[model samples]
Target: MELFEGRPADCSGRQEREVRVYDLLDRLGIAYQRTDHVPAGTMEDCDRIDAVLEVTICKNLFLCNRQKTAFYLLMMPGNKAFRTKDLAAQLGVARLSFGTPEDMLRLLDVTPGSVSVMGLMNDRDNQVQLVIDRDVLKGERIGCHPCLNTSSLRFATSDLLEKVLPAMGHSPILVNL
Candidate 1:
């Protein structure tokens, strides 16, 4: 395993989820860079990881409507402010709140800071709708934790939106933020 410092350190015994993500990328022929880091579960932690990875790690928020019948996993630029009202209006759902850790684990198979677009791979039933901010779509490359917060990965934005999602049978809703 390579540390975020760009040095090839041994990630040999850890990172099962990240390994699966890399395998998925390899199978899809999507190029990416992986950076292993200390486990982080907050925005501050992500900032530290970003310094090493040299690209912004997107903020992934797992949300559910009041009824919990509708779930959304939203990805956006880390610096952007999230306005719940705007999102609710655009999505035509009632107010959305951060999902509980248990819900995240059960629905996306992810813990708190590890929430990511790759988690959609486990969303076989398509229960959680994926939403991406417009700014995130314009980036040349996007960074995300591979299904865990201890490591981050980068890939071309086009590959992620066009190839990987389609392969995973997920069609993301693009929302202008």
Candidate 2:
């Protein structure tokens, strides 16, 4: 895949949700680089995208508490293993399991393969909390999907933490795991 700056010039076939991501980031004045590729459902699939984008695409997970009341969006290194018990103690939550696609779509307006921190923009009700792994925060840049796995985007870590998160009314909880 070739890296393109900002949104695709020709958005003819792009999904509305993907275009919305570009619109939001552009309006926020957050600089980013983008690349279009096949739908990547697994980390192995993202490896190619990561190589071309030159940044590891964060493994974004949509999770919910057992009762399904509390929802969270987790961003971590693709290589890192997720341990619920470890994250549970940090969040003071009893347990966390993969959120269903139904809840993911209802709250984040995203599907399984496209779960991203950018989707936090759709959570206007603040139903989903944002969580970032320390390792990811330390990076100068991070990559994520535009609420669609067919494409990925890269931007400064600071822009995401300082500009995007605040703009979305989200205060991310940093966890180490």
Candidate 3:
């Protein structure tokens, strides 16, 4: 994969959701680097994308409580081990489990392999809460899919916290794990 300064010049075959992410970042005046690749299905695939983007791609999980009423989008270090019990304890929730693909699409407008903080833009109802690991915030830049697994983007962490998230109308709850 090769890194480009911004969105592709020709978006003829790009997914609309991915293009929307680029549009939002441009509108927010947030500078970013982008790389297009095949859908990442494993850690090794992500590693290659990370190498090209020069940032550790976050492991974004779409989860929910047992009742499925409360949904969450979690951004954590790709290398970190995630224990549902640990996060459940921190959030004071009963049982946390991976949400259904249907719910992910309905809430974030993203599918299972494409969960991303950028997807928060589609959550107009504010139904899904953002949960980010503190470790991810320590970095100067963050890497994530642009609501699609076939492409990845990296931007200033500050842009995400101060600009992107705010523009998306979602506030993140920071956790250690």
Candidate 4:
């Protein structure tokens, strides 16, 4: 894989959602680095992408309560072990489960493998609450997909916390797990 300064010069075959991410970042004046690769479906694939980007890509989880009334996007380190009970306790929710692909698409406009904090831009209605792990905030830079698994992006964590998330109108709920 190769790293590019910003959005691909030729977006011919790229997904519209992917381009929109670039558009938003550009409008926000958030400088980022991007790398295009095949859809990342496994840890090995992500590790390779991480090596190229020089940052560990976050493991973004789309979760919902049993009734599906509350939706959340949890961002954490890719290598961290996730326990639903741990997060549920932190949120005071009885249970938390992975959201369905349909809900993921309807709410965040991203599929299972493509879930990322960037997808929160599509949640204009504030349907999904952003949940971030404390450890994720310790990093100087954040790595994530651009609403699609075929590419990944690296940018300042401060830019995400100070600029991007605020511009998207979503306030993140920081948690320990």
Best candidate, lDDT: 4
Off by over 4 Å in 2: none
Tens digits of per-residue lDDT for model 3, 40-133? 9999999999899889999999999999989999999999999999999999999999999999998889998999999999999999999999
Better of 2 and 3 by lDDT: 3
lDDT (Cα atoms) of all candidates against the true structure:
0.83, 0.92, 0.94, 0.96
How far in Å is the alpha carbon of 86 misplaced in model 1? 0.7
lDDT of 2 by residue, 1-177 (tens): 899889889898888999999999999998899988888976677999999989999989898899999999999999999999999899999999999999999999999889999899999999999999999988899999999999999999999988999999999999999
Off by over 4 Å in 4: none
Sort order, lDDT high to low: 4, 3, 2, 1
Lowest lDDT 10-mer window, candidate 1? 1-10
- Provide the global lDDT of candidate 2 against the true structure: 0.92
lDDT score for residue 147 of model 3:
96
* 61: Cα error in model 3, Å: 0.5
TM-score of each: 0.89, 0.98, 0.98, 0.99
Error of 2 at 66 (Å): 1.0
Q: For model 4, how many clashes?
A: 0
